[model samples]
Target: MEEKIKDVLDAYTFQTTRVCRGRGAFICDTDQGMKIVKAYHRSPQRLEFEQLVKYTIRDRGYYYVDQLLPNKEGQYLNNNKDGQMYTVRDWFEGRECDVKNAADVLAAVRQLAVLHMLMRRCDLSEDRVEQFSFQDTRQIFLKRRKELRAIYSYIRQKKQWNDFEKLYMQLYSDCMQEADAALSELNQFDFDGLRKKALDERTLCHGDFNYHQVILNRKYTAVVNFDKMHYDIQVKDLYQFLRKVLEKNNWDSSLGTMIMDTYLSVRTLSEEERRVLYAMLTFPEKFWKISNRYYNSRKSWISSVNYDKLCRFKKTEGQRQDFLNIFKYAFIF
Candidate 1:
């Protein structure tokens, strides 16, 4: 960790040092500070993509993000070193956005709208920024299904497996089959036409837009985490926000409607986009598959966490169906 900090500060020569870990490595000062250092233990490609996103947002005069620190080489990130990709940015103190308040929720919608608009203007091809299309999402689901099923089979064969474990294995299999069917239907849909329509109609999108990514200061809301930023359907981001709100609270249809209404008021969605929203609801299932693969591989700690959350949410099947019903209302499926 100390070595990672040195790599991050190699460009700035900062005096203070503190580290906090979340999705990636973050270095800050012990006291109130002005700068932040973020390092990823992944490939340089990811860091480069993040830097590109930061540059794009900053160039458009969006102050929601911390400014990328430039080295003497005039690069915002250091890629010369192997196994360490790091960049520094100006730090802003803030808190997470409030979800209960209607005004706060509307504000988040507006912010997402602006973000989507900005992403629409970006030159994604130059940065090798690939959009997560329906095809890619389907492929991920299929891959995850295969992996999870293998894990379940292994668990079932184990001598020490209990009744609860066996029940969960059956549940996992059932969910995987459901996801597979949904993905197959999604793959057969007119995704090409949908993609062209979405691109031509909608603005830029923060692919992983959610309340957690939005930080609230006294009077302004700032968005962070551009790592997953991409050019895709605007509803993709909108649905992500809606899903979180449903997950956090009971399935609140009014809240979901208000968010959609606010976003559409800012940036209108086409009939085709509305039709594609149901297909998009299945996108989160891809992430579940990815998470399951990671858990099975022992590569991520999220499997246990996500499983617990899903179990808690599963207690209210009607609520789950109600939330899903929102997507059905949007799409023909």
Candidate 2:
């Protein structure tokens, strides 16, 4: 692996003293500074899209992104002998974000808001946006609801119940009931009307925004990995980060409120945006995800850890509801 990375590194003109793995990518000590060498398997078109995103962020006076480095051949990507694609970017000095810490969480969310303001200026066609439909509350809920029904049936047919299955059955009714109510509300909402308004003011979402992707030094120094960058309502990133932090904070309403307030402090959200966020927060995503992973895993036997996660989800259900209620009312039109 070192040799392969070294070979890729040779393509660059930088003088390197040492190279080692840094988290999910390779890092090197170059005369210029630290540089990250990462590889991906994306299509040429998607690569072009990300290339556009890189410059868009940089040009907007934001330098926190993983700026792609062109090799000696003047290409952003190096297709090696093994057919693997790699890219090198200047690395920032920092540590991964600590989601549990309120300050760190606030810093990351503020960075996201800044990124969104820059990305919203980019002019990408609507269809080019991956997961664009997810911005629509109706599509998001209806799709998850259908997937949940299938998983519910899959577990019901099993004669022998696993521990996960038992707890799943116990909570299935409540989860489904919540999902149904969300769907009903979504159905009555003017999805097309709100969606059109959102589209008129769309921006890019850090599709995989989380503590891991964020780097902190006093403040958030960088947000690495735009591999999941997509054209969507920017709140997608905020909603995702909120969900993750809320789970870690035991779904505490105060923490949830603090995070939301912190993010809005940097970027204001409109009523339509808040409504979409509300629907997303209200969805039974955790339950569906656990069931999805279990059913999707090729392994015949299920992992007990998944059951533990489901139990934790059940234990924290009340707190999540409380937080959601607070958010819903505070933002209610």
Candidate 3:
């Protein structure tokens, strides 16, 4: 560990018995327990907000959160001599939730429902309330849809094209159709009212909840990385987790059913939440993501990884459609 890190750890109350390198930080086995020390890049207020949400979850008896620990001076964030900020939080002795493993995935889903149940209506300061509120998704979707058209126009005018560009051009029409369908479906609902209701309830989403942040250990299934938590439709969290796991499993409807059933067992979804999830699934998120990355990057030398992702997305279209059909029939109807 760097001497600066040691200096920072010394500020904490725990006595560091040993230290080792972790994923992106230092793993220090201290007197209190296993703690992770990493350079914090966000503002101190953001860290304070994250800490507040985690503490709220813990206070409600969900102690599996990786909360930031305060230093000797009673501050969650501390600056080193060089003006670098560091934060130490509780770490777990476990592996990431395996999306392919049915048991692990189900457990994670159930825990997510429980977390959502507890994460609602956190008291935010008046100033931070507007800052942390959900943005207008309607305008956001229109912007992305417009950008998709722009990308198509840009690729079409190119004098020469690579394999990725050729494939993107081939798939552009179908991708736009899906995007239109998602927007159409979204327009059918009281999206504005849904946002208002969620805000009134003070629902908070894990924001970046996925298998990577879910830790599976013997004692508990721990959820980490709350840096992106914000006020929004909580089902947005469920939709994201389901899309990721289903994509990895070739969009298996059986697995999808199990996930939905598992979550429903803990907490039921309102009709609007269910519809919102289907609309979110209908969006060509993977296509948009690949295209967005391609458009933003230096295109003179395109990467094969992009081509591979495009190919995989193309190959899985049929299975994805089938799963969406089943989901709509079984859940959304």
- Judged by TM-score, which candidate is best? 3
lDDT (Cα) of model 3: 0.88
lDDT of 1 by residue, 184-244 (tens): 6566767667666555543356667777777777767788766665556667788778777
Predictions in order: lDDT: 0.63, 0.80, 0.88
Model 2 clashing-pair count: 0
lDDT of model 1 at residue 123?
Answer: 55
Q: Which segments of model 2 are wrong by more than 4 Å? A: 125-137, 197-202, 298-300
Tens-digit lDDT track of model 2 for 5-30: 76688889998888888777898889
* Model 1 stretches astray by more than 4 angstroms: 1-10, 13-33, 42-49, 78-85, 98-105, 124-135, 147-163, 169-181, 184-188, 196-205, 282-310, 330-333
Give residue 10's error in model 1 in angstroms.
6.8
Pick by lDDT: which candidate is best?
A: 3
Clashing pairs in 3: none
Q: Candidate 3's residue-wise lDDT over 24-73, tens digit each?
A: 88888888889989889988888888888888888899988888999999
Report the alpha-carbon TM-score of model 2 versus the true structure: 0.92
List ranges where model 3 is wrong by over 4 Å.
none
Candidates in descending TM-score order: 3, 2, 1
TM-score of each: 0.73, 0.92, 0.97
Backbone clash pairs for candidate 1 read 116-204, 119-204, 120-204
